[model samples]
Target: MEILTGSHERAVTTMALDGRLDALEAGQLRGILSETIERGDVNIAIDLSAVDFVDSAGLAALVKGMKDARQAGGDVKLVAPKSADAMRVFELTRFDRVFEMASELSSLVEKW
Candidate 1:
């Protein structure tokens, strides 16, 4: 998987993910989020539009990232999970309620 970074008007940063989010890639995702938070960028939006699949490890990474962000006085939101499988993972895990989701990056960035 490939993770790309972008910034918004506020201090919010976006991580656009491409490819599958599986066990191996999940660790990379965690590392990226941890590094971002360590740099004092707590408000993060994960753009999962390009992600076609996600497993339990991927979900755990997201959950951990969200927890760390919240503890840093910020949050992590999901943006445009267009894939049915990706959306299903969130829905089945009930992460849709835990993390704020938006149809677009602009909508999520506006929240910060």
Candidate 2:
């Protein structure tokens, strides 16, 4: 899995998540996101359009990222999920509300 990260603006950072996100890969993403958020980022947009799969661990990592960001006085938003499996997980977990779900990366970043 490749988690490509870059800043689109001073306040917004984008992570293009690709490949599978499960227990084995979740930790890598977790570390990357935590670092990015901790570095004074106010808005985050995760481009999951390249993600092929996501499991419970992946969901947990995302939740942790969101929680950490909000707790830091910021916010994290999820762009449209590419994998149907990931979509199902989000829907089943009712994360559609916990995280501001957006169909496009631009919309998510524009919110803040």
Candidate 3:
């Protein structure tokens, strides 16, 4: 997966992810999220629109990041994936209810 992260003026970290988010890439995502939180950038907006696939490991990594961010008094918001197949994972896992999601990254960024 390719991850492009940037810091916004509102102190939110915006990350745009592309490619498959599977076991091989989950660890990388987890590590980057950890580093971002460690640096006190706990409010993260992850744009998953370009991601074509997701698996269990990817879901776990995202959940972990959300929990850690919430604990730090911030939160992790997701920009819903455009792919119905990719979004099915979140729906089936009931993560759609657990996460705060938006259809557009710009919408989420505005709120943050």
Best-matching candidate per TM-score:
3
lDDT of 2 by residue, 2-112 (tens): 888878764788888888888999999899888887778757788887777788999999999998988888777888686787688788888877888788888777776
> What TM-score, over all chains together, does every model reach?
0.96, 0.91, 0.98
- What's model 3's overall lDDT? 0.95
Per-residue CA lDDT of candidate 3, range 68-103, in tens?
999999999999999998898999999999999999
TM-score of 1: 0.96
On lDDT, the stronger of 1 and 2 is 1
The order by descending lDDT is 3, 1, 2
Candidate 2 TM-score, true structure as reference: 0.91
Off by over 4 Å in 2: none
Note the residue pairs that clash in candidate 1. none
Q: What is the lDDT of candidate 1?
A: 0.91
